[model samples]
Target chain A: MAKNKTFEEKMKELEEKVTLLESGEVGLEESIGIITRAAAIIKELEKELDDTEGKLKLLDLKTDEITPLSEDEA
Target chain B: METYSVSQITKKISCLISADTTLSGVAIEGEVSNCTLHSSGHLYFSLKDEKAKINCIMFSRDVRNIDFLPEAGMHIIAYGRVMLYEKTSTCQLQATVLISSGMGILHEKYNRLLKQLEAQGYFDKEVKKPLPTYIKKVAVITSPTGAVIHDIINTIRRRNPTVQIILCPAAVQGSAASGELAERIARINRHNLADVIILARGGGSLEELWPFNEKELADAVYASTLPVISAVGHETDFTISDFVADVRAATPTAAAELVSFPLEHYLAHLSAQRLRIAQATTLRIEAYRQRLKVLKRPAALTQMLAKNITGHRSNLTTLRKQLAKTAETMLIMHRMQLANLQIRLEANDVSSTLAKGYALVKIKDKLLQNKEQAALHEPIDVIFDTFRLKAEIVEIKGETYGEKQNI
Candidate 1:
C-alpha cells in the first residue's frame, strides 16, 4: 500500500490476492476480506489511470535542477 | 654523443623515435593517399591532413583485420609506432590497426567498443533487469527538442496516459552528447525518479548516432539501477546502448510502449478477474445451498413416514376382515347350539304327550302325578305346547286298586 510502490507492484498484489481467493481454501470471512482488498486496489488503479497528466518538467543540464514546463510554453 | 656512421645515426634515430612514449604508440587520423598493396602482403600508404602527411605501413597480419581495402583518398585512423626506415633514412609509422574514417570509422569504433564491452560482460543477459509490467513513471534522456522526444511522449500518452514522464534533456549528438546522456542517467538514478529509463533518438547517419555507441553511455546504461529501454535509431540501426540496455526498441515510440502497459489491456484483465470471481462466488453459494438442503433431516423423515402409512393401511384392512370372519363364526356356533337344544325339546315331545294323554294337571303351582298324595281340594293348572289352564285340586283319592277316600 505504500505510495512509493510502482503500478506493477500494486498489480502483482491484486493478482496474488485473486489467486488466493480462487484457491477455494479460504474461509468465507477471509474470502470477503480478500474481495474487499481487491476492490480497493482496483479502485486505486483506476484512479491512477484516470488521473494521468502529461506534465513535462525540464532538467538543467549543468545544475541538475528541474523546472516544470508550463502548458503555455508548448 | 659520439660520432657514428650513417647506419648507426639512422638506427639511433629509430631508437629515439621508438623510445618516445607519445610517438611509440600514437594514433593519427587522416585521409590515405598513394595506397599500395605489395606482393609480400604489406600495405604502404601516406596518412595526410591538409597540413601534413606521414608515411604509414601495415603488415599482412594487421592488414587482414581491416574490413576495407585501402585506396587513394580513403580517410582513416592509423594506430602504430613511429620508427625510422633505415634504407630511406626517414621516419615512418608502422600501423598495427588501420580503420577508415567517417562511417567506416564510426562503425569500426562502435564494433571495437562493443566487442570490448561484451568481453567485459557488460551485456550479459544475467545483468539485465526485466521491465516492469506496469510502469507508473518514466525518465527519458534525450534531446529535448526533437521528433524523438515528441514521438515518445505522444506514444505513451496515446497508449497509457498514466505513466509520469520526466524528461531529462541532453545532447543527442556531437562530442559532449554521450557524457551528458550518461550524466542525466546518473542523476535520475540518484533521485530515484522513475521506474524505468528510456535513452532515445531519431534515426540519423552513423556519425550523428555515434554518441550512442560511446562506451561511457553504454556503461551508464549498464550501471542504471532502473531498467532501461534503448531506442536510438531506426529498426535497422543498433547501437551499443541498445545491446547494453535491459530492452531494445526499434524506435522512440516503441520504447514508450515497452515501458507502459496499455490502458485497455489493464481494463480487460481487471474485468476478466471480476467476472471469474463473480462466477466462483456464485458457484460456492449454490453448492452451500445444496448442502443445506440435504442437511435439513425432516424432509427425509417425512418421506419415510409416508411410505410406512401406505404399508399400515393395508395391514389394517386385513385385520378388519379377520375380525369380521370370527364374529360370523361365533354367531353360527351360537345358532347351532340353540337348534340342538330345540331338537331335544322336540324329541321330548311334550306337546305330543300332552295330545295323547289328554291333560296334565298341577296343584299349588305343582303338577300332581298321584291322587293319593293330594289333600282335600286344591286348584291346579295344566299347560300344553299351545295353551295353559289354571285349576284347583278339590278331591283326594286313595290310590290302590279300589281304595278311594273322600273328605
Candidate 2:
C-alpha cells in the first residue's frame, strides 16, 4: 500500500514542481527527474479524487431509497 | 511769657505730653476707620465707637506680626499706648498689637471677589485656554530693567533658545502703573505677534505690588484670547492677575520654564521614531523577499501542468470504464429478460400446445372452452395442427379427466 500524502503537502509539492518546470532553466536531465516526480504527484492527486468520488457515491447510495432505472431498460 | 529758648519750649511740651500720655498698655475695641497702610508698612486708622473716636497707629513691625488684615469698618482690638502727636497737635493710640474682632477683612474681600468671578464663569476650566507647550513668541508685559524680565529671559533662553521674546516695557509699581500695565496688555494682544503673554514683576510690599491687583488689569488678562502666564512677586504672594490668567507661575523663571520645551529631548524622540520606521520597512522588504524565493521554485510549474493533464486523462478513463461496465450490465439483464419472455411466449403458442398432444375442440361454430358447453348430441370439430374432425358426443361419460396441463 502506498503511504498517503497529506492534502497540504501534496498541494505544496505539486505547486513547487510546476514552478520549477515553467522557469525553463533546469538541465534536461534534471527536467526528466522533476517531470517523473510531477507525474507521480499527479497520479496521487488522481487517486485522491477517485477516492473522494467513490465515497460520495457510497453516500448517495446509502441515502437514496429509489433504485435508478437504466435508460435502455426504461 | 517766660523767656524760654527754642529747645526749652520743645522740652517743656515733650515733658507735659509725657506726663499726660497713657503709658499703660490698653486694649481698645472699635471698628476701623480711615485705614491707611503707609509705604513704610505702618498702619494708621481711627478706632471709633458710637459716642467717641480715637486716632490709632500700628508700627510696621507690629503690623507684620498681625495674621488678619485690617480694613475700614472691620471691628478689631488695638493694644498700644496713648501718645500725643506733637506735630499734628493731637492725641492718638500708638498700637503695637492688633487683632480682628472675629472675621478677617482680607478673607471677606477674597470671598466676595471669588463669588463675583464665579458668577461670571471666569474660573470655569472649560473657558480657560490651554497654555502652549512651546511658546515660540512670548510677549512680556513688565519693566524692561527689572530683574523679573532678566530672570524670565535667562530661563527661556536656557530651556529653548529659539523662543522669541517681545518686551512691552511698562511701569510695575506706583499709582499709574496699573493703568499702564492694562494698556500694555491690550496693546500686546492687538499686535497678535505672540502665542502667549507673560505678566511678571519682582517681589515688593503689598502696596507696591497693588498695581497687579487692580480690577482693570485682571479683566484685561481674563479677556485675552491668547493664554497668559502671571508671575508676580514671590511664591507666597498672590494677586488678582494670578486668578485671571490661564496659568499662574510662582516666579518669573518658573513662567519661562513652563512654556519652553527641551530641544535635546525632542530631537531624541524624533530620531527614535524615524529609526522605528526604518526598521519596520526593512522587515517588510525581507518578508517580501522570502515570499519571492518561495514563488521562484522550478518544480511548481511542471507539477501544475502535469496535474491538469493527468486529471483530464483519469477522468476520461474513468468515464470510459463506467460506460463499459454499464453497457455490460444492461446486456446481461436484457438477455435474461429475453429468455424469460421467450419461454412465456412459447408456452402460450397454439402450435406448441398441439405439439404437446393437447387438442382444442369446438361445437358448431363455437370453440369448446369447457366440456359443459358441449351437448351430448352436439356435433363437435377437433382441431389438430394438420387436420380437423367433426364428432358427436353420444354420452359425455362424465367429462374425461387427465393430469392437469400447463401452458
Candidate 3:
C-alpha cells in the first residue's frame, strides 16, 4: 500500500502482478492496468539496482582509509 | 530383616520408587559411559560422576525421540524413572529424555547464561531490529587476519560485488576479545555508517569461543541501533551473542549472505518480469487481433461504401488498410492500447528514480505528484524515469491494486 516499499517488497509485488496477468483470468483493461503499475515498480527497482552497484567504497582492515575501490579491486 | 523371595522384593522396590514422584520423573546430570544401543532400538547406558554410577535404560519407544546414539564419555542430563528390574532384581533408571551437554561445566554455564538473558528479554523479537530492505554498506567485526574475514569477504563478493564492507577488526578469542568486540559494535553504531553489522569468528571449542558468551558483548548488541547478525562459531555452537543479536547466522559466510543482496540474480529476475508483462500484453493483443480477423472483416462493409466515400477509388484492395484502421478506431481500447504498448515495448532505459517514489498525478510530460492530487486511473510515462510520455485520462478509483498498469 505504501510507496516506500523495500527492494524485496517491490520485487514481490512485481512477481504477484506478473503472475496475475499470466493466469489469463484478468480482462484486457485490467491486464493493462497491472502492467502500468508494474512499470513504476520496475523503474524504482532498476534505479535501486544502479545505486547499489555504484556503492563500491570500502574500509580496509589495517588502514582507516575510506577508499573507493574499483569493481576488481574491491 | 524379614526373609522374602527375590521377585517379591524387586516388585516391592519398584512400587516404592514409582510411588516416589521425585524418583519417577527425576533428571540426573552426569557423564555417560558403557552406552549400548540394542538392535531393538532400546538404549542402555550408565551415568557416572567421580565416586558413583547409575545404570540407565531408555526404552525403544522413548529412544525414538533421541537423535544421537548415547556414546561413551558424553555428558548428558537423563530424565525418566528410577526403578528395579524384576527379572535381574537390579536397581536402574528408565530414562525417557537425554540432552547432550558435551562440555559439562562450560555447557552448564552456557545454559544458565542463556536462560538468564532470555528471561531478561534479550532474545525478544520485538527488540530485534529489522534488516534493511537492501543493504548497501555493512560493518564486519572479526579477526583482521584469518579465514573468517576472508571467507565472509569472498562469500559477499561472489554474491554481490557492489556491497561495501567496513572491517572492524577485533580479537575473536581470549580475554581481550569481548571488550574489543563490544567496542567495535559500539563504534559502528556511533558513526551511523552501515546499513547492518556482522559480528563473526571462525569455529573453535567451547572455551576458545567463550568471549562471545560474555555479558559485555551482549550489552553492546542490545544497545546497538544497527541490526546485528551474530556468526560467532560453527552451526553446532550457539553462544549468548547468537541469542542477543538480531539474527544468528550458522557461519560467517552465511552472515555475509544475509547482508549482501544477490545483485545479478535479482536484476535477471526484474528483466524476466518485464518480459513476462510484455508477453502477457502481446498475448491479449494477439487474441483480440485474431477475433477481429475472424469477423466478416470491414472489407465487405467498406466495399459497399467505397463508392460513396472514395468515389475515385475503383481498387478496394488498396483502400483495405484505411478500412481496417476505421474498424480498429471503433474499438477505442485497441487504438490507444496499441500506442501504449509501443511506448512500453521500447528500450527500458531508466536514468533516475522519481523525486517522489511514485507520483499520484501527471500533466503533459512532467509528473504532478501531490497529496492533494486525486488517485485516478490516468496513464503516465512511468518507464525511463526522466523521460516523458503521452497518456489519456481515464476513470479513477481507490487503490484496489493498480489502476493504469498495462494501459
Candidate 4:
C-alpha cells in the first residue's frame, strides 16, 4: 500500500463501497471482501490523520530541496 | 550677435534647451500654481520654489498616468524638459511625469499597473481556480526569519497536525523581494512540491508591503498551476496579490486555517459513516430475518387448513340429509301411485268379479251373452263363483221376440 493516495480519495472509496453494500445486492463473499478492504483503508486513513510528528519543514529555495524544520524553526 | 525676429529667437532657445541632456531629463520639486487642464487635454501649470518659478506643461497622455488629480498649491515633483514656447515666447518645462512624493508616487504606479493587469483579465473571477478541498502539503512563501512563518506553522500545527507545511524562505520587502517571491513560486510549480502555495507576509504600511503589489509577483501568483492563497497584511489591507490569488486570507494564520482540515472533524465524520454503514446493513439484514421468521411459522397455515376441513365436513352432512329426504319422499309417492293402479286393475279383473258372487255362462268354451248365441242342440256351460257347470241345452226359455234373456 503506497500512501500516495490522498485521504479524500480513500474516504470516497470507502463511502462508495458502503453505499453498495447497503444496497443489499452484495453476496457473502463480496460483502466480506468489501468490508475487509474498506476497513483497511479506514484504518490507514485514521493512522495517517492521527500522526503529529514530522509535520513542518523548510524548503531550500536555492537548491529546491526539503529539510525538516525543528520546533525552534517554527 | 545676429539680429533675429521673436519667433526665430524663441525657436533657437527651445532648440538649445532640448539639446541639453540634463535639462531634458530634469526633476524639479516645488509648489504647484495656476494649474488648469485645457479642453485640448493638456495641463498648464507653474512650479515654484519661493526664489523663482517655471512654467510647466503636462500632455494628456502623461497626465493619465498619475493616480491623483493635481490641484493648485499642492507640493509635487515634475519630471520633463525645459523648452521654449514659440508662440508665447516663454520657456516651459514640458513635464511628462507629475506626482506627489512618498506614498503618492507608489500609489500612482500601483494604480497604473492595477488598471493594466485588470484590462488583461488577470484578476478575472472566472479565471480563479478553486482551492482543493483537501490540501496535504502547503508551501508558505514568506521570510524565514519573520514571525509570520512561525505563526502560520504553529496555527496549522494546532489546527491540523497532519498537514505538512513547507516554508519557502523569501524576502518580504525591499527592491529585490518581488523578484525573489516570483522565483520561489515558479520553483514550487516546477517541482510540483506542494498542493497549494501561500504567499504570506505580516501587516505593514503600503510602502513596506509594496513588494506584494509588484506586477511581477502578481503575474507569478496568476501563472501558478497550483491554487494560491495570498495572506499579506492585515484584514483591511488589500494587495494586488490578493486579487490575483485563488484565495485571499486576512492574515498568515488565516491562510493556514484555510488549507488544513481538523483531524477531530475527520475522525468524527469517519465514525459517523462507519456507524451509518453498519446500521444500514444491519437494518436490511434484520428486515430479511423478520420475513424469514414469518415464513417459518407453519402453525398458522395448519390452523387455516383445519378450519377449511371442518366447514367442508358440515357441508357434506347437510347434503347427505337432503339426499335421503328426497329418496324417502319419492318412495312414498311411488307406493301411493302403485296402490291407485292396483285398484284400477282390480275393477276390470274377472276373478275379482267372481269373488263378488257373479256367474259367467258359456256355450262350450264360448261365453253366452244371450240365448240367440246358442244353437238348438249345442252344449252350454255355466260358470259360478267358485265352480264351472257343464250341461246340454234341453229347452230354450225366454225366447220371446220382445227380449232374449239368459236365466
Highest TM-score model number: 4
Q: Per-residue alpha-carbon lDDT of model 4 for B94-126, expressed as tens digits?
A: 998876764577788889988999999999999
Q: Each model's number of backbone clashes?
A: 10, 18, 10, 0
Query: Docking quality tier of candidate 2?
Result: incorrect
After superposition, which runs of candidate 3 have C-alpha atoms over 4 Å from their true positions? A1-74, B1-109, B124-133, B190-192, B205-207, B261-264, B287-407
**Model 3 docking tier (incorrect/acceptable/medium/high):** acceptable
Docking class of 1: acceptable
B82-115: candidate 1 lDDT, tens digit per residue: 8889999877899999876765666778878988
Candidates in order, TM-scores: namely 0.58, 0.50, 0.45, 0.59
Worst lDDT run of 10 residues, candidate 3 chain A, spans A52-61
- Please give the DockQ score of every candidate, comma-separated: 0.40, 0.01, 0.25, 0.46
| Candidates' chain A TM-scores | 0.78, 0.63, 0.66, 0.87
lDDT, candidate 4, A1-74, per-residue tens: 64677777888888998888888888857887887787788888889887878888888856889988888874
lDDT of 3 by residue, A1-74 (tens): 45787666888898899999988899988878888899999988888766645444455434555566554541
Worst 10 residues of 3 chain B by lDDT: B347-356
Q: Between prediction 3 and prediction 4, which has the larger lDDT?
A: 4
lDDT for each residue of candidate 3 in B167-223, tens digit (9 for 90 to 100): 777889888999989988887787786889999988887767989999999999999
Model 1 lDDT per residue over A1-74, tens place? 56665667888888898888778888888888888888888888777778865456666667666667653332
How far residue B350's Cα lies from its native spot in candidate 1, in Å, is 51
Model 4 chain B poorest ten-residue lDDT run: B398-407
Candidate 4 stretches with Cα past 4 Å from truth are: A1-3, B1-100, B300-407
